[model samples]
Target: MNYLKKILVYALPYKRYAILNIIFNILYALFGALSFVVLMPMLNILFGENHDVITEKPVLNGLNNIGGYLKDSLTYSIQTFAENDQLKALTFIIILVIVVFLLKNIFNYMALYFGTFLRNGILKDLRDTLYTKTVNLPISFFSEKRKGDIMSRIASDVNEVQNSFLSVLEIIVREPLSVIFSIAIMLTISVKLTLFVFVFIPTAGYIISVIAKRLRQQSADVQKEQGIFLSILEETLNGLKIIKGFNAQSLFNSKFTDSTKRFFNFSNKMMNRQNIATPLSEFLGIVTIAFLLWFGGRMVLIDKSLLASSFIAFMGLAYNILTPIKALSKANNNVKRGNAAAERVLEIIETTNPLEDIPNAISKTNFKTSIDINSISFKYEDDLVLKNFSLKVLKGKSVALVGQSGSGKSTIANLVTRFYDVNDGSITLDGDNIKSLTKHSLRNLMGLVTQDSILFNDSIKNNILLGKENATDKEIIDALKIANAWEFVKDLPREIETNIGDSGNKLSGGQKQRLSIARAVLKNPPIMILDEATSALDTESERLVQEALENMMKNRTSIIIAHRLSTIQNADLIVVMQKGEIAEQGTHAELILKNGVYKKLVDMQSFE
Candidate 1:
C-alpha cells in the first residue's frame, strides 16, 4: 500500500481525470444495480402474475421503506398499463430494461474514458522523471550500475508499474462500488439470503489471500531476472565486435539463454499464482449461487414469505456481486506485482547524488588569472589516482602535462571540470575554490577535446552547433576552417549538412577529431583542455589535428595532456609526472637539458 501511494502521488497533477472517473464509476455502479432491479417487473409480467389492476397511485413514504414503496409503485404502474393495453405495458417494460442497460453501458464507457487520462498521465510523468534523474546523476553513479538494469527500470519496470499499479485506479473505485451497490440491493430483496451470502464471502477472501502470500516475492524475482537478461542483451550489443573478433557468440548466447530460462521459470510461477485468483473466486461465486438457489427455492415454494419475482431479482443482484468480487481478487494480485516494480523504479528516482552543487555555491561565469591545483588527493574506489599533486596554469599561457598511462594526467582535467571532486585539498580559479562555484559555470569557462571524439549521430551542422547553442552559419564555417575540418566537410556530398553515423562512425579518426576541435573552437572558451586529442590519428592525420589544436590553443589558458612530445614542444611550461607525482617541470628546452624523467621519456618516444 505504501508503494501504491507513492506511485499514485504522480497522478495528483491529473486529479481532475481521476475525480471524473470516480464520479462516472459511482453512476455506473448505481445503474448496474438498477439494471438488475428492473428485471423483477418484467419477470412478473411474463409469469402472468399481478393480474389485478392498480386503481390508485402508490404513496411516497419515508427513506426507511423507500425500497418497498418503489417496488409497490412500479407494480401499480405496470398493472395500470396492462388494463388498458397489454401490448403497451409489455413494450414499456422492455424499453425500460433497454434504457437501464443503455445508461449502465454509457456510464461504464465514461468511467473508462476518464481513466485513460489518469493511466497515461502517470506513465508519462514517471518516465519523464526517470529520464531526468538518470541524466542529472553524477558520472560516478553509473560506474557501479549496469546500463541494462537502469534501462529495464525505466522501460520494462515502468510498464509493469502501469499495468499492475496505475491500471488498478479505475477498478479500485468502480468494482467496489459495483459490489457495494449490488449487495445493498440484494439485502433489500431478502435479508435472510443476504446474511447467508455474508458468511461465505469472508471464507472465499481468506482462501484467495492464502494463495497470494508469495506473489509479491515471486513478482520481484521475475522483475530481477528481466533486468538481468536485459543487461546481457545490452552488454552483447556494446561488445559485439570484441565477441565476434574472439568467436564468442555462442558464449554470450548461452549466457543470455540461461538468464531467459530463469526468467521463464519465475514468470511462470508468478503468472500461475496470479491466474489462480480468477478461477478460485469464480468457482467460489458459483458455489454460493448454487447454495442460494437451493435455500431460496425452499423459502419461495414452501415458506411463502419471499415473492417469485423478488427471488429472481435477488439472484441477478447476487450474480452482479461475483463480477466485482472476481475483479477485486485480480486487482489484489496486480497490486502485489506492481509493488515490486515500484520499488525498483523508486530506488533510482530517490538516489542521493554526492556531487550535487552546494546550496549557496557561487556561479562563476568567466575566468581571470591562473587555475591552482593545490595539494589535492583523489581516489576511484580503493586505489589513489592522484596524491598530493599540484599544478598552475596562468591566464593565456599554455601548460602541457606529459606522463605514462595511469599517471593521473587525465585526472587533472577531470578535477578541473568537477566531473569528480577531490578527497583532499582544493582546486581554485583566480583565488576562489572551484568547488565553491557551480559546476555549470565552472565548465562554461572551458572546452574539452578528449582522446575519443564524442559526436552524436547527427548532421555535421547540428553536431558543431552544440558548442555554441545559437551560433550563426558564418561562425560555424569559420570554426570548421580554424579546426581544418572545412576542407573535407566542403567536399562531402552535403557538406556541413551531411549526416554522421552513430558516434560519428562514418567519419575517419582524423575527420572526427577535427569536427570535435571545430565544436570546441565554436565555443571559443577562455580555457581549453586537450587530452591526447591526436593520439589515435595516423602520421598525416596527426599533423592536421595538431595544427587544429595549435589554432584552438592560441592565446588560451590551455591544459594539454599529451602523449606525443613533439606536439607540446612549444608549450610555455611542461610538467612531467611519474606514478601520481610530478618528476619534472620546466620549458621543453630546460626539460631536455635536465636529462631526467622528461628527457628519458622524449628519448624513448624518439626511438619508437
Candidate 2:
C-alpha cells in the first residue's frame, strides 16, 4: 500500500478521467444487480406453486418508488400491446430483459473508454519522468553502473509499471464497486445466505495475500536478472572486436546464458504464484455457493419462510459477487509485482545529481589575458595526481606537457575541462575562477582531440559538423581540407554523405585520426587541448596529420600532452613532469642542453 501511494501520484494529472471511469463503473455495477432482480419477477410468475393468492396488491420494499414508476409505465404499454395481440405481454418482458442487458454493457463500455486514457496517461508520464531524471544524474552515477542496467529501468521496468500495475486502478474503482452492489442485492434477498459469503471471502483473501508477499520479492529478482543479461549483451556488442581477437566467444556466451537461465527460474516462480490465485479463489467461492443452495432449498421447503423465485435470484447475485472478488485478488498480486518495478524506476528518478550547476551561475563567453593554474593540488583518492602544480599560458601561446604514462598528463586535461572538480586549489581562466562559469560556457571556449579517434557511426560530414552545429558546408569542406581529410572523403562513393560505419571502421588508422583532427579544427575555439592526437598512427599518417596540427596551432593558445618528443619540438615551453610534479621546464633545445628528464625521453625516442 505504501508503494501504491507513491506511484498513484503519477496519475494525479488525469484525475478527471479517473473520476469519469469511477462514475461509469458505479452505473455498470447498479445495472448489473438490477438485471438479476428483473429475473426474480419472471421466475415468480413461472414457478410459484401457490397461485391462489396472486391477486394480492404488490408491495415493493427498497425500490418502491422506481417500481411504482415502472409499473405504471409498463401497465400502459401492456394495455396498448394487448389490444393488438395477447402474446405481446411475453414479448414486452423479453424486450425489457434486452434493454436492461444493453444498459449494463453500455456503462461497461464507458468504464473501459475512460480507463484507456487514464492508463495511457500514467505510462507516458512515468517514462518521461524517468528519462528526464536519467539525463540529470551525475556522471559518477553512470561511471559505477552499467549502461544496460539504466536502459532496463527506462524500457522494461517502466513497461511493467504500465502493464502490471496500471490495471489496479481499474480494479480499485470498478471491480470492488461491482462486488459491493451485488452483495447488497444478495443481502436484500436473504441476509442469512449473504453471511455465508462473508465467511468464505476472508479465508480466500488471506491465502491470496500470503502468495502476494512472495510476488514482490520474486518480481524484483526477475527484473534484476533481466538487467544482468542486458548488461552482458551490451558489453558483448561494444567489445566484439576484442572478444573475437582473443577468441572469447564461448566465455561470453556462457555468461549470458547463465544470466538468462536465472531469469527463467525466477520468472517461473512468480508466474506459478500469480496463476494459483485465480483458480483457488474461484474453487473456494463455488463451494460456498453450493452450501448456500442446499441451505436455501431447505428453508423454502421445510420452513415456508422463503420464496422460490427470490431464492433463485439471490443465488445468482451471490455467485456474481465471487467473480469480482476473485478478480480483485488477481489484481492485488499484479499490483505487488508492479510495485516492485515502480520502486526500481523511482530509485533512479530520485537520485541526486552531484554535478548540477549552482543557481545564478555566470557564463564565460570570451578569453583575455591568461589561463592560470594556481597551487592546484588534486588526487583520485589518497594518491595525489597533481601536487601543488601551477602554470600560466598567455593568450595565443602554446605550452606542451611531456611526461611518462603516470605523470598526470591526462588528469590535468580532465581537470581543465571540469570533467571533475579539484579537491584543492583553483583553476582560473582570464582572472575568473573556472568553477564560477557555466559548464557549457567553459567547454564552449575550448576544443579537444583525444588519442582515441572517437568518431560516431555516422557520415564524415555529420561527424565534423558536431564540432559546430550551424557550420556551413563550405566551412566543413575547408576544415577537412586543412586536416588533409578531404582527399579520402571526396574519394568515397557518396562523398560527405558516405557512412563511416562503427567508429569510422571503414577508414585506415591515419584516415580516422585525420577525421578526428577535422572535427576539432571546425570548432575554432580560443583554447585547444590535444592529448597525443597523432601518437597512435603510422609514420605516413603522422607526417600528414602533424602538418595539420601545426597549422591549427598558428596564433591559437594550446596545451599539448604529447608522448612523441618530435611532436612538441617547437613548443614555447616544455614541462617535463615526474611523480606528479614539474621536474624540468624550458624550450625544447634548452631542455636537451640541460640533459634532464626531457633529454633522457628524447634520446630514448631517438633510438626507436
Candidate 3:
C-alpha cells in the first residue's frame, strides 16, 4: 500500500481529473442509494398498503427525527397531489424513481469519463519515467541485470499498477461511499434491522480478507515467471542464427515450456483465490437477506411493528448495500495484486545511481595539454582489473595499448569514457579531475568507435547525425569521404539517405566499421578512443578501415587499444601489458630491437 501511495505521485499533474472523478463518484453513490429508497411510496400505492391520507406537511422537529419527517412528507405529498386518483399517484411515483435513477447513471458515466484521463495519464508518465531512468543509469547497472526483465517492469508491471491504482480509488472512495449511503438509508427505515446487518459484515469481510491475503505472493510469482520466459524469448530471438546452426531449438523450447508451466500453475492458484470473491460475497449476501426476511417478516405480520411496503423497500436497500460490499471485497483483492507490481516498477524508478554527476560539478567544453591517469585502481568483482596503473596522453599524440585478452585493455577505454568511475585515485583532463566535471561535458570531449560498430536502425544520415545533431549534408559527405566510406556509400540506392537495418546489419562488417569511423569523424572531437575497431574484419576490409582510422587519428589525442600487433607498429609508442600493469613501453622499432615482451607478442602473431 505504501508503494502504491508512492506510485500515485505521478498522478499529481493530472490532479484535476482525479478530483473531478471523486466528486462525480460521490454524487453517483448518493443518487444510487436514493433511487432505491424513493420507490417505497410507489410500492405502497401498487399493493394498496401503507397509504396515509394526510393534508398537511409534517414538520422536522430536530435533526434526529429528519428521517421520520421526510417519510411523512413523502406520504403527505402523494395524498394531496393524487386527490383520490390512483393511477395519477402511481404515475408520479414512477416518474420520481426515473428521475433519481437517471441522475445516478449520469453521475456514474461522468465518474468513469474523468477517470479515463487520470488512469491513462499516470500510465504514460510512469512508463516514460521508467525508460528515462533505464537510459540514465550507469553502464554497470545493466551488466548485472537482464534486459528482458527490465523491459517487463517497464511494460507489463506498470500496466498492472495502473489497473490497481484504479482499484484503490474505488476501494477508498466510490464503493465504500455507496455502502455508507445505503446503510444510512437502511437505518432510517429500521435501526434494529440495520444493526443486525452490521453483525454479518465484519464476519464476511474477515473471510474475504483471508482469501485476499494469500493472493499477493502468488501474483508476484506469476509476474516473476513472466519475466523469465520473456528473457528466454528475447535470447532466442537475438541468437536465432547460432541456435539454428547448433540445432539447439529443442533446448530453448524446453526452457520456455518449463517457465510457462510454472507461470501456468502460479496463475491458476492466484486466479482461483481471486475468483472466490464474487460467489462467496453473493452467497453471504443471500444468507444475510434470508435472515432479514424472517426477522423483518415477523415485524410486519405477527408484531405489526413494520409496514409491508416499508419492509419490501428496506429489503431493496439492503440488497443495494450488498452490491457495493461485494465490489469492495473484490477491490481489496485487486489492491494486493497491484501492490506487487508497484513494488517492481518503483524499484527501478527509485534506484540510487552512484555514478550521477557530483554537486556543483564544472562542465568542461575543451581539452588541452594532457589526460593524466594517476595510479588508478578498479575492480568489477573481488579481483582488481586495473591496479595502481598510471599513464599520460599528451595533446596531438597517439598511444597504442597492445595486450592479450584479460590484460585490461578495454577497461582503460571504459574508464576513460567515465562509464565507471575509478575506485581509487583519479583521472584528470588538463589537470582538472574528470569527476569534478559534468558527465555530458566530459563525454563531449571525446569520440568512441568500438569493436561492435554500434549503429541504430535508421538512415545513414540520421546515424551520422547522432554525433552532431545539427550537422548538414555537406558535413556528412565530407566525414564519409574522410573515413574512405563515401566510395561505397555513393553507389548505394540512396547513398547517405539509405536505411540501414537493425544494428546496421544491412552493411558488411568493414562497411559498418567505416560508418562508425565516419560518425566519429563528424563529431571531430579533440580526443578519439578506438577499441579494437578493426579486429573482426577480413584482410581487405581491415586495410580499408585501417586507412580510415589512420586518417581520423591524425591531429587528435588518440588511444588505440589493439589485439593485433601489426595495427600499432606505426604508433608513436606501443605499451605492452602482461597482466594489469604495463610490461614494456617503447617505439615498435626500439621494442623489436630490445627483444622484450613486445617482441614476444609480435613473434606470436607472426607465428600464427
Top TM-score model: 3
Q: Each model's C-alpha lDDT?
A: 0.89, 0.83, 0.90
TM-score of each: 0.95, 0.89, 0.97
Q: Which numbered prediction scores highest in lDDT against the true structure?
A: 3
lDDT, ranked from best to worst:
3, 1, 2
Better of 1 and 2 by TM-score: 1
* Candidate 1, run of 10 with poorest lDDT: 163-172
* Alpha carbon deviation, residue 217, candidate 3 (Å): 1.0
Q: Give the total clashing residue pairs for model 1.
A: 0
What clash count does candidate 2 reach? 0
Tens digits of per-residue lDDT for model 2, 416-499: 988777888999999888888888899999989899999999998899999999999899989999898899889899988889
The residue pairs that clash in candidate 3, if any, are none
Q: Write the per-residue lDDT of candidate 1 for residues 1-608, one digit (tens) a residue.
A: 56867888898999999899899989999999999888888887777765666678878777667667777888787767666476777788899899999999999899888888888788899999999999989888898888888999999888878776434764578888898999888877778999988888888889998998899999889888888889999898878889999999999999999999999999999999988888889899899999989999999999988888889999889889888877777887888888888999999988997778889999988888999999999998889998899888899999999989999999999899988999998999999998889888888999999999999989999999999999998999999999999999999999989999988989999999999999999999999999999889999999999999998888899999999888899999999988888999999999989999998999999833
How does residue 199 of candidate 2 score in lDDT? 80
Record all residue pairs in model 2 with backbone atoms less than 3 Å apart, i.e. clashing. none
Worst 10 residues of 3 by lDDT: 46-55
